[model samples]
Target: MKTNVATTLAELKKNEKDDFYSSISFANEEIPLEQESVKRKLDKYLRKFSYLERSSHQIHRKADQLLPRIAKILKSYGIPDDFKYIAVVESSLNPGTTSHKGAGGYWQFMPATARLYGLRVNGKVDDRLDLTKSTHAAARYLKSLYSEFGDWTLVAAAYNVGGGSLRGSLKRQRKDNYYDLKLNAETAAYVYKIISMKTVLEKG
Candidate 1:
């Protein structure tokens, strides 16, 4: 019985590792998990992102309520449902949070970007603070990014680092691929973290 239990535990760990390191579809694109470089980065983030499992009770609870609504909104805009994880990445499924740069709410829309996407962001009415409005605003912004990058991975990167900055990096590095392009630390880790968060929420 002890030997059998040990074998089962080992098998479980192997399966969990495979689940973390295996190829996954993100934004309707197949990520090349067989690639060594991609696997390493993903493993690194999965190790760090494991904190979510330990300290994410509230996040998980809120996500149970919010993700379905976010999914419907993303689908209506023709976005892949995977993009809903961006909210988890941005604000950990918490609303009414603001970044130092003024990106706020679940989707983390900056005031200017929120307004550009047809959300009102003013003293009297900061629409970025509203879950439904901010999500719609995020969809429009992500759609614009997709239009610009023509690739979902690049679109996700552009969402993090700003389209213009991502474009400039692609031009300078001569690499259009998110994994290949040279980026700041935060942007470099952004896609991996999103993937990790998606795995955690879905697998749990």
Candidate 2:
């Protein structure tokens, strides 16, 4: 079993290095891999998630325990099940991971964002750390974003950089497409990370 897992991960890395990826997608939107830059960018994240982060074994173990609950909550809100990958990309399925900016929980919601989405984040309690509560909050937040952006790819981008910042970038750049926008480095690659996680986690 250990050897099989290692082989699978190694195969993923090898495939990423080649043109084995004939297509890529996010939120039902087909990524235009005909564009060499887009293909390379996504391939980089694929390698990062499949090989460079916590071991595939560790991430898969945590994901096995977490994604089902996250998926159920997202579906309850009428959101795409694919959005569960947001949690994977954000926190690597680690319920206790905290960001330097004080964002905590599986969904990585900052204090203000957590409170805005009906989560309590006071001194005595931080609902952002609760799996069920935070996943629900994240679903509501994603629904709100989808209403505004009307695109799951854009919603994913907004989730990382905030709706306001994404709107400003879209306006300044005169581009509604997430892939074409000149966002900050992090936001630009954010969707790709989610998609990468989706691909690896789902395929495995």
Candidate 3:
């Protein structure tokens, strides 16, 4: 079993390297690749790294396992598929993790935010650490922010910073785009980090 696993990993590595080289072609001092071809390569690499073969039921397990169920919940709530990454970013889809700042659960809500969103927060019980309840709260909050901002990126930004703060920054900078606006270090890199994690999880 060990030898087989090692061989499988080696094959996957070789395949990924092949995919990388095959997709890139240099021209006019720039690199370009056909969209369809690149996507095929990526899809192949992602399939090789699929979570279905893994047995370690930790963060990856939680994220991979819960996504389908969470998708259903989000669909029922009329939320977009993109919001799925928010739960992954929050607690790595783990229900047991807690931040030092007191954020908890798959959605990682602070005490105040959890309370405001109607998730119970107390010594005897902390529903902020519960995946289902927290995700529901997060979905609702994100939907409300989307209604206010009319942009998914802005809603993501507001999730990092407060909605009022993000709106103020947009007004001051005269740019509503999250990628273009100057934000605090944490908020600035937050979305990109989430995106990177998404790529890794979806492709690993």
Best of the candidates, TM-score? 1
lDDT per residue as tens, model 2, 140-164 = 9999999999988889899999999
Better of 1 and 3 by lDDT: 1
lDDT of 3 by residue, 45-158 (tens): 344434432534465776678887777777787776656877876776777788898788778888899889889999899987776787788888888887999877678879
Candidate 1 C-alpha lDDT tens digits along 1-204: 999999999999989878755545677677778788888898787767777677658878888999999999999999889999999999987777889998887889888888899988887988877788888989988999999889999989989999999999999989868888778999999999998878777766
For candidate 3, what is the lDDT?
A: 0.71
- Which is superior by TM-score, 1 or 3? 1
- Sort all candidates by lDDT, best to worst: 1, 2, 3
What's model 2's TM-score? Answer: 0.87
Candidate 2's C-alpha runs over 4 A off are: 1-23, 53-56
- Per-prediction TM-score, please? 0.88, 0.87, 0.70
| Candidate 3 residue spans exceeding 4 A from truth | 1-57
